[model samples]
Target: MAKRIIKAETVQITYREAIRKAICEAMHQDERVFLMGEDVGRYGGCYAVTKGLLKEFGPERIRDTPLSESGFTGAGIGAAIGGMRPIVELMTVNFSLLAMDQILNNAATIRHMSGNQFGVPLVIRMATGAGRQLAAQHSHSLEGWYAHIPGIKVLAPATLEDARGMLWTALDDPDPVLIFENVMLYNMEGELPANAGPVNIEKAAIRREGRDISLITYGGSLWKTLEAAEALAREGIKAEVIDLRTLRPLDDTTIIASVAKTRRAVIVDEGWRSGSLASEIVTRIVEQAFWRLDGPIARVCSEEVPIPYPQHLEQAAIPQAEKVVAAAKNLLSK
Candidate 1:
């Protein structure tokens, strides 16, 4: 029922506002769409993404649930099965672990368990990653762990267009979808396309193309990778940057194609180094494009230690531009 946006006009927006606009657009288009989460109505969201939504949409649609993640998550799943499109927002990825039973056992399984008689068209949005010095309580990035499951789609939107578009597309999905917005990206400012609309959720996007090596990454790490690419360019070492917008399905074709051409890869992820999404991408490259590799695949990931509260320690624990540049250089030298 929504009309395509006209591309003649342009606007600058923050990542938080883009997501809020997408939610507003979806609710306006579909009567069944609603948003609910802790402090989502009155408190304006943990990151202020829903600042005015409660007043605009009213109490019924912009519900403010109690502090129980498991309780509201299960409720959202039930509501989705009851012929309503519900976007449930958890404050952080660490909080989502409390609702793993509902997300993994219920929302992701209803379609197959019921012989295709029922589907859970739920959209769960949460802030993920570290850089805020919020310690382990709120700064962990576990979206990769969620990617290990069979059902549900995992999306990480690193740009303004994606922040605006992925939400509506996720709402339209028949199965459950999880959108992970990096906590640090909420305040990031950028120019969005005048008529930015739904983007393809099935493929990886190449931000910068080069032949030397592929800088494979997603989420907040994309910008750092891009920065590293520019720095490498100065030294005459071209690096291709691949943004993996979707994590669960892992765009194997695009990834393999990029690796096959570059013949080398360095994955940057905010998740832990061991058994992370970076590891998964590296494994895929080894399986499909092993012979294409001119050197061992390099990975820049967060250290295995807990995210510290101090600024310096937290920065050290997370992947940075310098580390990515070093990783790229090491791969080329090999």
Candidate 2:
């Protein structure tokens, strides 16, 4: 069969509105799909992404679970196994830790553990990254931790198109998928194709094409990297920005090709530096394109500290545009 088309004429909308549209479309297309999470029903989503979905889908489909992450998450897993496609929402990445048993132990291992007889066609959506001054407890970027797992698919939708399209694809996958939406991107407004639909979740997309250096990132860090690229352009340095939309699969092909062309790289990640997704990407670049490199790979990551509540400290704690520019410049100068 020919591949499905998900794009059409273009229109402008906010990032959160795109997400809400995606969920609404998915539910309308398939009755098997339903949404469950804290404040998802009458209260709307914690970030207000689901503000009007409750009335549209009703209490049955738009479930409002108690504040028990583990319990509701596990219930979602069970419901998935019973032939229902459930979208379970965790308020934040930090709060997702409470559901680790159900996610890591069960959702990520069920297919292999059950000899491929059982599949978890579930989607777990949660907010990630820092910028809201929610403190350490509420603002953690643990998408990297989920990416470390083997079976479950990890996705970070950084752009309006991905926000509008990824959910339907995730719902179609046989295995479990975790979508990490950067809380800061919710209000971001942009124009998207009116016919936008499910996009391929297996590859990275180069937001900007350049030859001097490759700035690789995903989710919240994407826009920052793009800004840094613009700054580098002003200084006569062209930088390529790659958005690794799928974290677990790590789209090594796109990453390697970019590094092979640019010959230098700077990874920007919102997670802490040590043993983070940025570290993993750097290692991959070294292993796959070491001979093509003109300089040592560098990374711009969050400082090794709990995200502080104070605005200045929190800004310091995470990767930003200036830091990415500096890292790229350093790589090019080397």
- Residue 44's lDDT in candidate 1: 97
Give the count of colliding residue pairs in each prediction: 0, 1
Give the clashing pairs for model 1: none
lDDT of model number 1: 0.94
Q: Write one digit per residue (lDDT tens) for candidate 2, span 1-334.
A: 9998876668989999999999999999999999999999999899999999988989999999999999999999999999999999999999999999999999999999999999999999999999999998999999999999999999999999999999999999999999999999999998998888999899999999999999999999999999999999999999999999999888999999999999999999998889999999999999999999998999889999999999999999999999988888777772
What's the residue-level lDDT of 236 in candidate 2? 96
TM-scores, each model vs. reference:
0.97, 0.97
Report the CA-based lDDT of candidate 2 relative to the real structure.
0.95
- List pairs with backbone clashes in candidate 2: 9-194
lDDT against the true structure, per candidate, is: 0.94, 0.95
At residue 169, give the lDDT of candidate 2: 96
Candidate 2 lDDT at 264 equals 93
